[model samples]
Target: MAITSDDVRHLAELSNLSVTEEEIEPLKKDLGAIVEYISQLDELNTEGVEPTYQCFEMENVWREDEITEFEAKRKDLLNLAPESTDNQIKVPKVL
Candidate 1:
């Protein structure tokens, strides 16, 4: 497929990119070559091939959940705060 300057400009706009005047021609040629190279895949013959979801053998490994306790106490943590009221941290109001 032949890629034109207009096609490049449209692609640039879709991709949120700003393309200069000098870059347009080079982009057009490069994009055209890429499309042509990918088009060659149409000639492949895969009549009896099975569809593959993953290339490797993989499975989800699960472990039992366990609860752990920390040494820090709630009162000690509250005392470290700069400002606290009614066992809760106090901060300036935000809209």
Candidate 2:
């Protein structure tokens, strides 16, 4: 695939990049080479081959969700607070 200057300019615009007039020719050549290289994958024989999504063996280890009682009681926590009103902690009023 041959990448033209116009293609490079369009790609630059889509990518929100500022490409100089001198950089366009080099970018076109580089991009053309990259596309050609990637196109070589079409020549591979992938028949009956399962697409491997992950290279490493992975699994989701799940456990039953249980609510355990906290060691500190509500009264204990309220006592530790700087200021408490009724059964809740009190903070400075905000606008």
Candidate 3:
């Protein structure tokens, strides 16, 4: 898991990162140590352990679906907009 100067340079180029030459050695050492620590996980024994994606069970607390009628003002809805023509709201082009 020891990352060399060449490895750092290759990684930087792949990621399109402009890394100065002085920063390469420190980055390589840091990344190499991280890989070394992650590889240590292989030493753990998880035999007979059931695999689980999440720790908690998920359920949605939602209100019951019900329909109700209410009076709406058409003029109030139209007046909320700054610009309207022929009962249609006008918007500027996005693209």
Best model per lDDT: 2
Worst 10 residues of 1 by lDDT: 59-68
Model 2 lDDT on a 0 to 1 scale = 0.93
User: Candidate 1: where is the Cα deviation over 4 Å?
Assistant: 46-95
Q: Compute the lDDT of residue 10 as modeled in candidate 1.
A: 96
Off by over 4 Å in 2: 47-95
Q: Is 1 or 2 the stronger prediction by lDDT? A: 2
| Residue lDDT tens for model 3, 1-95 | 68999999999999999999999988988999999999997899989989897778876668868876557677778888998878888899879
What candidate 3 gets wrong by more than 4 Å, as runs, is 45-95
- Can you list the residue pairs that collide in candidate 2? none
**Which of the two candidates, 1 or 3, achieves a greater TM-score against the reference?**
1
Clashes of 2: 0
For candidate 1, give the lDDT of residue 70: 75
